[model samples]
Structures are given as C-alpha cells and as structure tokens.
Target: MVITKTLDTFDSTKKLAGHSFTSGWLLNSLRENDKLYSQLFGNRLVKDITAFDVSGGKGFLSIVLRCTVFFVDSVNDTDDVYTTILKIPGFDSFKNDFLTDQLRTIFTEFHKSECDFYNILAPILDGPTPTVFKTVEWILDESEGCIHMEDLTMRGRTMTYFETVNLAQIKCLIQHLAHMHKNILCSDTKIWKEKHLKSSTGFIEVLDMMNESVEVLLKKCDFEGKSLK
Candidate 1:
C-alpha cells in the first residue's frame, strides 16, 4: 500500500491538492475514460479535485476523506459535481504490536468484505446502502485496499455516536436491518457463510475482560439484579 502522511502543513496540503487524483498511478490503471468512469462521472471531464480528512475514532485503521470532484461536459454544455467518501487503509506502523496486529488482520478482512458486498451482493439485493463507485486493491497486498463510495450524508443520512434516538427512528433502523438480513438469507446462503465474521480472538478477549470489570463494579455497588453471567 502507498502510505501517505497526514496533511498537517499548508504546503503539504497544497502540494497534494494540486494533483487531480492523489493516487495517480492507481487512477491511471482504472482508466478515466472507461465505461465504469463514464457511468460514475457521466462522461464529463474532470475540472478539479478537492479532498479533506474526515476521519473519526477509527483513524488508526483507516483514513476517511470527503472527496469532491467537479466535472464539465463540453459536448452537452453542462457541468456537475460528484461527492464521494474515499476510504484508505492506515499505515503499518502499529502492526508489530500484539493488539494492533490483530486489528490489522481485521482491517484487511473488512476491506475485502466491503469489496465483495459492493461488487457482488448489493446488486442482487437492490439494497439502500450507498453506491460504491470503485475499489482499488493495493499492488503490494490485495487484501489491503481503498474504495470510493457515494456520500450518504448528501442523501440525508446522518450518524451520531452517543445521542438518544426516538422510537420512530429506532423502528426505521430495525426495519432496515431486517430487510438486509432477509435479502441476504433469501439470496445465496453459501456465499455469505462464514465469510464476514466481524469478531477476532483479541476482540472477544477484550470484551470478556470488560465484562469482568463491570461485574466487579456491580458487586461494589451491591446491585440486587440477577448476576451477570
């Protein structure tokens, strides 16, 4: 994977911003004028590219960028703007540590799982998930990759980590999950079998440890509820 440092300084940011696509080599291989590109950009010539970091707490595993592409169609005398969420795997600096090593494996699997979902599964399901424009596997490692997906925020999708959700919103969320599960189960069972389990040994161990700590806290408080098993 091509590791790019964080854009901390103005000069560094400006230098990267000047490039049409920061990963020019990968983009070139994708072929800007291909059928897929035409479908994505509507055969419009790219006028400008702007990117900004929008990483959340998962910045250690991946870098999320909000990329805006401005395009112009000379033949039709029209212009349009496309916004996409670009996800790139993080660097390998933390791969040597015990905890991080496990995370690295999980992260790699996540990229492949998403690629499979977008390329194979989503089309058949006709799901409401955001559209994936392209997926570029790393030259050095196929498992580690990057992806360009439709920006759901533009379609009124919002995310809140700790905010309370209303009953209606909760019902809608549950319905969406049910629909996805139903579609997957009704589709090919073999394809979805044991392919995308999100838990690892390290993750389960940590969860167990947290549960032990919580049990101790409850004992100290003399809680009368049923014992946490």
Candidate 2:
C-alpha cells in the first residue's frame, strides 16, 4: 500500500498511541479468530509484524492503521508478506469534549453498525468493499472494537481534494452504486428489515445535526447577504 503520500511516517518497531496493544497483541487477536485467519492464511506461522498508524487527520470516527505481516511456513520452507488495514475507535483522540459527550451513544451505534456491515453484509453483497479479515463489535465496558481488512490502496488511486471528476468516472461510480443496491435488495430482506426501520427513526435527528452544522458554518464565514444565506 502507498503509505508515504498523505499518511505520516510512523515507527513500526515501537508501540504507538491510540492503540493499547502491540504487534504481538494483533497476532494473538488474529489467532483467536481462527476460522477467518485459517480461511485467509492457512497454517502459516506469523513470524513478525509491523504496524503504522495511517489515520492522520483524515479519520474522525476511527483510527486507521496499515500492518504488514511476515509469515513463514517451516514445512514448506517459504516466507510471505501480507499487508492489511486495521481500524479502531477514534473517540479517545477526539478533542471535542462537548460533542463527544453529547453524541457518544450515536457514535457507538454507528461503529457497531459498521462492524456488523463488514462482518455480515459485505460478504453477501457484490459491492466494491475491502476484503474483511476480522471485525470486532463494540463492547460496552471494554470499549474494544475494530475492523481489519484489505488495503485497497495497493490497487486503487485516490482522488485529490479539488480534482475534477469527469462524466465517465461519475458513471462508473453510479454503476457500482446500482450493483450494490441490487445485491442488497436481492439478498435476504430479514437482514436489513430492522436497519430500514431504525434509519427511518434516526433520519430526523441526522437532518437536525446537519442543519446545526450548517448554521455553525454560516456564522464562521465572512460572506455577505445572498451569498451567506
């Protein structure tokens, strides 16, 4: 994965902030999720692992990390390197105390929803999503939740902030959206029944949050009259 561009350079050898555990902890976590790990890497012995926090300023709800695992198969006398992305809760690093306190429940729900999506829906739908390695649902007391998946950057390109997207790109995105929607509808409806109801109830709250955010932006901007309105 391309880690040098937007992500800051981090020391992979040392334990970093935002994470309570080291590379060893990660390996153990993977082992604990034996079924998934076996499906992906089989019986390869993981010798060493290096991790870098790539979240930088881009992530608001979660911290993103890129990890490289070096595996050795003694029987086969072969070694291989595997790279993946690890995402964990970002609430610890979030500086807005007022907002954090007010929206903690909402954030927790969102995180759990995402974890479930990756674990359940992602595999069933033919969407352009990363390949999942592991997903830990948010725990109440422990506050431990994470999503480990493939780093698409290895094969994909990121668009710049002000880059103009052409018609062809827009069409491609629309096509992907359509495919995802079709898969969702075609899949077992029971999986999404509760989510559809939940989302409907939360829609007004989301709109209120958006309106408040816009008001704050309007107060900050120097635009006058019609432009400001």
Candidate 3:
C-alpha cells in the first residue's frame, strides 16, 4: 500500500511493460519522475538546464536526458504533446523536388563562397569569424507534392530560422564550406592555389532553389479563398 501510493505521484498507474523513464535524480526527479521516462528514453543526452526555463527551451532541454522517437510533454494535465525537429524521415521521403533542389543549391553556393574565402577574398579578413547554427524542428515535407515542415512546439529547440531570410548567412555558410574544402580555407595558401579553382554552380543553384521555395510557400499559404482551415 505504501509503495503503491508513492508511485501514484504521476497520478496514473499505467505501466508500459518494457519501458521506464529516467528518474531519482534531484533536478529531474521533482517534475519528471517516472520509470517510464527512465526506461523508455535512456539514450538521450542531458544538458545544463539552469538557464532554459525562461528561454522557451525548457521542453527541448528536458528531453536531452532521454532520447525517443519524439518529444512528449503534458501541455495540460489532460493533454500530452509530442514534437520533433525533423519529421520527414530520410531524403527519399523528402520528395519536394523544388525544395530538394533548393537545399542542394544552398549547399553548392556554400561551396563556391568557400572557394573564394580560401583562395582570393578570404585572406583580407584578419581574424577568425564566428559560426552559429540553430536546428529547425520542421522542414517542408514535399514527397506528397506540397509544402510543409512539421511546425514545432514553441519550446522545442530548432535550427535557426529567420524573420526575413537574407543572403549574408550564405556568405558565412561559405566560410564553413571553406573549412570542408581545406585546400581553400585552411592555413595553406600554396596548396589552395595548387588545387583547382572555385565554381559558382553551387551558389546560383541554392539561391534559385530557396527563391522558388519561398514563392511556393507564400502562394500555398495565401488565405484568399482557400480551405486551409
């Protein structure tokens, strides 16, 4: 009777046969205690959560301790919400040709910019540049011939998204690209010159792809007379 009452803290006694939650730890035990979380989601990495309660990051950071197919939390005492950053599965399911083409294009432009930074235009910058990335929880799912990325929970962490997307990040991305093409961005200029030249094929391709995606998304979401409801 005593043990049963303590276990009732979760207020529900549904036991998932082979699953459990990570619990008993001080910081997490108070709110997230449950054998279900411990057993069902033991693979996730945990991170420092002291500063997240206010950053809209509490949800994502909390799940770091337990990896699962999706993020789940109780939205209200009566509701459970599950969210994920990438929802379209693998590349095969990501069939929006235009969006695929756009991502590839961005990758290509990233390559071109990298070449310039590595060979000619890069040497002028005297110091190392900063790099940042935020994961996007959703991307447009196109395999069905429409635009849709899984919209995320307000608290779930995601890749950086922009209010007004711009070209500057592409330039920064190129710098990262330069790092990949070590011949160009590394500390060896002599070797960079020895290697072949840069190409704009990637840059133009990405720009064109993103432009197309933006146009398509805007059109699809227009509320003129559509039943998007």
Candidate 4:
C-alpha cells in the first residue's frame, strides 16, 4: 500500500513530529539518547524554528529547503542552534502528456533507486555522502511518488558546481567514486536481490528510441552528413 500526505509549509516556532524542536523531536530525529537530551536541554524549551528556501539548485525533479532550529540550552540557559535540509519532489501537475508520462516513469524509478541506496547500499559504503537522518516517500498518483531526505547543508556541506571545480577537488571526487565502486564490487549481490533492485535498461532503450526519431528527421530533411547513430 502507498501512503500520501499533503506537503505543508512548516512553522518553525511550533511543535513538529510530536514535540517542539527544543523538547524532543529534534533530538529524537537525530537518534540522540535520553542521557544526552537531559545533559543538553536541562530546562529551557525550544523557542522558534526558521526555514529558508535554498536557491540555485537546478533540477526539475526536486526542491530543497534549509531549516534552522533554535532553542535555549537549559544547562547554561543560553541559545543554541542547528540546521537540517529537506528534499521534496517536484511533481505537482503536468500538462504535456508525453513529458508527463516520461517524467513519471523517471521519477518513480529514481525514488525507488534512492530508497534502495539508503536501505541497501549506504550501510556498506565508505564513500563521501551526506548523513541521512530520515527518508519519507509520498505516493502522489498510481505511478508517481516523491522522496524527502535529511538536508546535508545543515552540516556545512555544499554542492560542487562544475565551474567551481579545481584539479585537486576533481581528484578527490574521483577517489570517492573509486572507493564507492570498490565497496559495491566487494559486496554480495544477494543484498541487492533481497531489496528487489535490478539493473535498469530503460534509459538505454529511451536513447535508442530517440536515435530512431533523429534518423527519421534527418532523412526527411535530406541531410548529407553522417546520421546520428
């Protein structure tokens, strides 16, 4: 069965997920033990919460929001703060039938793949990736769904754009990729089988279809150059 929830703008100053940010929800989501909570919020309660939409993320599939949590520490009676990012899928409604169908398939597979990644692959991987605090999937339609994950930005992690890459950074990225590949190569294939994740050939099939369309267009135009094979 699939579950659905209306995406609502969160009010930072109120209770979230059963408790105020200063009371229990924040620490519980972080998986902090009770001892740590007593040591941290001795008496003071969480006062307010704030969220800012992080811009410049170029993607049609999802939207990102950065949340800042505020609370007063009970021990010293001082203010303390923390942050977390929320990733929400971007499928509200579609006008174009072809595009909508294509995107629905793509988004569905993407969400399932990510869920598999967090559930199956991440535990064994020693690669550079954000710590996932939680993941929630919302069923929108029969074949469409969205995923929400913990924001890595709260931990000072930033996205690396192509224009900002340096040679050193590129090398580091390659090393991280290599480490991930090695970990996957060493893991048992049964782990993936248990999760019902199989390799996908849908993208390659789509490319082939596009190539055929290109060939037809080229013939119709009577182009002389080599065909896009």
Against the true structure, candidate 3 has what lDDT? 0.35
Residues 1-229 of candidate 2: C-alpha lDDT, one tens digit per residue: 6665332133334553446556766665566654556577755656566777776767767888887766654343233566667888756554453353436666667777777787778776777787776777776457577787767766986677998999998999999888888888888888875763332344354455666667666777844234633
State which candidate, 2 or 4, has the greater lDDT. Answer: 2
lDDT of each: 0.58, 0.66, 0.35, 0.54
| Cα lDDT tens digits for candidate 4, 1-229 | 9897542233434533322122234444543423433465434355555546574555445655565556644243233555565555654332353354665566566666776687668887777666565565545463223233455553555556654777999999899888888887888877764464332654653564457667777888887476556
lDDT of 3 by residue, 91-192 (tens): 331246745655644433343444345344444343343111111222233221111112234544445656454589778778766665663454566744
Please, what are the lDDT tens digits per residue for candidate 1 over residues 149-224? 7666656645577878899988998887888778887887787677656643435644544576677778888873
* Residue pair clashes in candidate 2: none
Q: What TM-score number comes out for model 3?
A: 0.24
Ranking by lDDT: 2, 1, 4, 3
Q: Could you tell which candidate, 2 or 3, scores higher by lDDT?
A: 2
Candidate 1's clash total is 0
Q: Estimate each model's TM-score.
A: 0.60, 0.68, 0.24, 0.59
Instruction: Point out where model 3 deviates above 4 Å.
Output: 1-96, 99-125, 131-191, 194-199, 220-229
